[model samples]
Target chain A: MITMTRETLFNLAMMAALILFPLWAWLADEPFMITLATKAVILALAGVGLNIALGLGGLVSLGHAAFFGIGGYAMGILASHAQNYTPLIETPFLIEGTKSMPVIWLVAVICSGLAALAIGALSLRTSGVYFIMITLAFGQMLFFFTISWPAYGGEDGLSIYVRNGFPGLNTLDPIQFYGICFALLALVLFFAARLARSPFGLALNAARQTAERVETVGISPYKLRLTAFVVSGMITGLAGALFADLNRFISPTMFSWQTSGEIMIFVIIGGVARLFGPVVGAVIFIALEHLLGGLSDYWHIYLGVLLLLIVLFARGGVIGTLTGREVAHD
Target chain B: MTDPMMTDPVLETRGISKTFGALQASKDISLTLMPGEIHALIGPNGAGKSTLIKQIAGGLRPDAGQVFLQGREVTGLDTPARARLGLGRTFQISALAMEDTVLQNAVLGALGASGRPFRFWRAALGDKDLRARAQDALERVGLQEHAATRTAELSHGQRRQLEVAVALTLRPKAFVMDEPMAGLGTGGSLRLTGFLDGLRAEAPILLVEHDMDAVFALADRISVLVYGEVIATGTVEEIRANPDVRSAYLGDEA
Candidate 1:
């Protein structure tokens, strides 16, 4: 048998807790708790997506909400059209809406990927604060565009009354839907793990630390960062699609910069580069929201204080504090 | 096959120049590195040795003239493109991924040369050949023992050795090195000088150094630069004898 390190053991325990917590909530007839877990899983998925860029590639994107919103809208527009039995566009190449989960996922991932390519191409031209502002600008542009776009419910947002069906599964059952989401989170976590250890990941990590060294080694940092950004956007877009389905609603708020910040917060608080850091972070954040939110109306005050503490004393983040070794120590 | 004694040279530059606003950092410098030979570029601080190296390595574009690896004009290509075409370089500063292991740094270099750094499906740690190649590179620098140690934890001299180990993975046709002995102690320089002496059999070296003793010991030919111009280029003894080189660069020390 292979020996498991403390990190691996901790990761396994966390995954188990994620699965069992929702199950126990369901058994205890707490639908609200189950829903909370589902939200955490989906949000963790988004965090995983961001971690690839922010942690691995060191590309801090403030416009990731653009991709997330694109995904939500992709699901919203397609499901809404399918429900109304309307063709999406009246062009010569007639386009129809889809209600299939697989189809929605494909569209959502593609739309976000395309949006990311465009945004990355423009934002990547500038580095550091410039990159951050350009990305935020793109997010704001998308947010306003969605508000103005009256065709798909605009500022009020679109609603999917019925959850889309996955193959061989009744997505109507809360447990089934949660299972699908949890499974996807696991799959993506697996992908993130594989990616973080791949040769590309090594090169990207090198690019993040020292572009000059990466260049002298015969690899383009620009190309690596761009690829990572696109992949990150696509994954976050997938999470957004699932999130919309879970809530049965999609709104312009999905495109807010605050969503981008929250997603980044998960990566930071958990552990920037650790595979399961975001998962642990999401759980901690949700627990804090539930526990502290009950005690005070201004919960953000506590959240801000906690974040300050983590940044000051526990800069390596929750996982870093637990392991003593840095998450970035590959 | 290559003519070691050929005048055509393995790497060459023609009239390369760069202007940083009012400051003309490098100006119309021409140089060459023949196969199986070490060509040293020696100049005092701010003599534009680094600027010329950057121009040749594609970090900075020369305001005038061209750079050639073999016979191809690569003036417009970027640094990675030049490196991909078998040109290797070592930075004066330790430009390694400090978060990774020494082995991982070498692996990245090998992956760039192998054209498979983009493979995302398989685990990078599972590639036997890649690991072996990286190990071989570390072994070349006599640092295979410390392969698994974090790069940040490596000592200064060890990091410098790791730099050469990383560069060697390129299997370069000619090396463009900038101040390889800038901060080396006596023993470190002696070891590196020995290593560099044996390395020319694999490929020619274009060395930029401040250490006159190491220069005279290793350089088959030397080019003395003064204020971004090649004041003299000749055999070590000839360069030592050149009055312009002595007055402008070497001074009374020559």
Candidate 2:
């Protein structure tokens, strides 16, 4: 029964922009613009994943890139084995690499979800700064572990010789690839919207607002948070899989704390808990990086200033300010 | 008066004591809440009334004691486990989900007893049974009209009523209410006193309160706690006539 507000309208417009810009780029034979749009959608998807934990569960995890990197490695390791015509593992039953994008995405989600389960189990035992530090440490551990892993390229990154195949399309086509990423972002946004209204979502929101009250209600906040964190990791892992395919490269940099920071940035800039907040935030972030990066070598200084202004003047991120609703408490 | 030697108390605390570093927050206090009776625990501030309630509600562990609900030891249980065993609670400071709607808050309380809140794909609004239970609880607290209203927007009295509504859905064997009448106006207090008086017929209440008027009007039996010790345990008139209680706690205040 909730009516569409200006924020919802803005969300719709941004989604349309994502599609139209990529389509326009394809028509104009501007491959770079299409690539840029794809990156934005992929990153937005990752932010949507984080919002489930940060905005809904109030779990401020700083190591989401570990999930992102798991997805990237899932794609990288599989594609590399397929390219070299080698099986992934020589166990009792041989395990082979996959060239299917869907299969790669599945593997990515599973790996990220399990990793999240383990990390969240330990990190969630602590709250506030301790949680932030524990998650950061986990991310760093993975980053170093990947760096020392010589089988997948060690400090040197792994590259996919060819983009993984979609069921019925040439993924090499800039427009087609862009379409997949955009559609996925839309899907996760839809899922996130559904989740925010579900019973689990209500309990998670309650836990975020009042942990003691939630406990009295007989729902464990820890269990709710762990579930949200794992789901978040799964979604981000999917996004990471696509990201690696987009660039045809995976490295320790994907697991870096800087990537985790950027992912958190997308959620904050978009509007925490706003369904399409991440999408809008990702669009702005990509626009800034592209436009400003073209204008000045030290575009980050300007980006920093802009981010500060938004944080200072706008209580809610872009979508929230436009919508006139700070957080989706509904 | 009820038999003082009754062995089958509804909710009993045996020799309960708790210490926080150098502070003896709760001393050896044994109390009983018989079925269908309001056992009001009244004390001055810093008398450790809150600590006793926390131990009963499983929020705090008594260094030495046993909390029994229906004669089953529950001292080792955590808050959630104790809540599942039918120990319903309301907070003095209005512990509620501020962002959630009245119905959502009610539903969360029911969600624990219902035992299946892990349904993520289906919309909560579509669940007819859960909504019905939530609506039913709201009706009990007279908040049925504001079912969709955000909890933050409710008045202080309304919020307290909603807390009762939330607890009612727990189907509790006993109620651990902390100052249910703390912020109520005279009218609201009277309304709640009537509600609590009626509520005892379903389950006993362990009320921790400072409001003497409400306590005298609602409590079936009164227990005075002073500096972590129970000064007097008796009926309303008995406590009123006790000189020791008059000097220590009631202080001619009651």
Among the numbered candidates, top DockQ falls to 1
> C-alpha displacement of B53 in model 2, angstroms?
1.1
For each candidate, report what fraction of the true interface contacts it reproduces. 0.83, 0.78
List, for all models, the DockQ compared with the true complex: 0.80, 0.75
Q: Which stretches of candidate 1 lie over 4 Å from their true place?
A: A328-330, B1-7
lDDT of 2 at A252: 96
The DockQ score of candidate 1 comes to 0.80
Which interface RMSD values do the candidates have, in the order shown?
1.1, 1.3
* Model 2: per-residue Cα lDDT over A198-241, one tens digit each: 98998898899999988887778899999999999999999999
Q: Write the per-residue lDDT of candidate 2 for residues B34-108, one digit (tens) a residue.
A: 988999998889999999999999889999989998889999989988888888999999888987888889988
lDDT of each candidate versus the true structure: 0.89, 0.90
> Number of clashes in model 1?
0
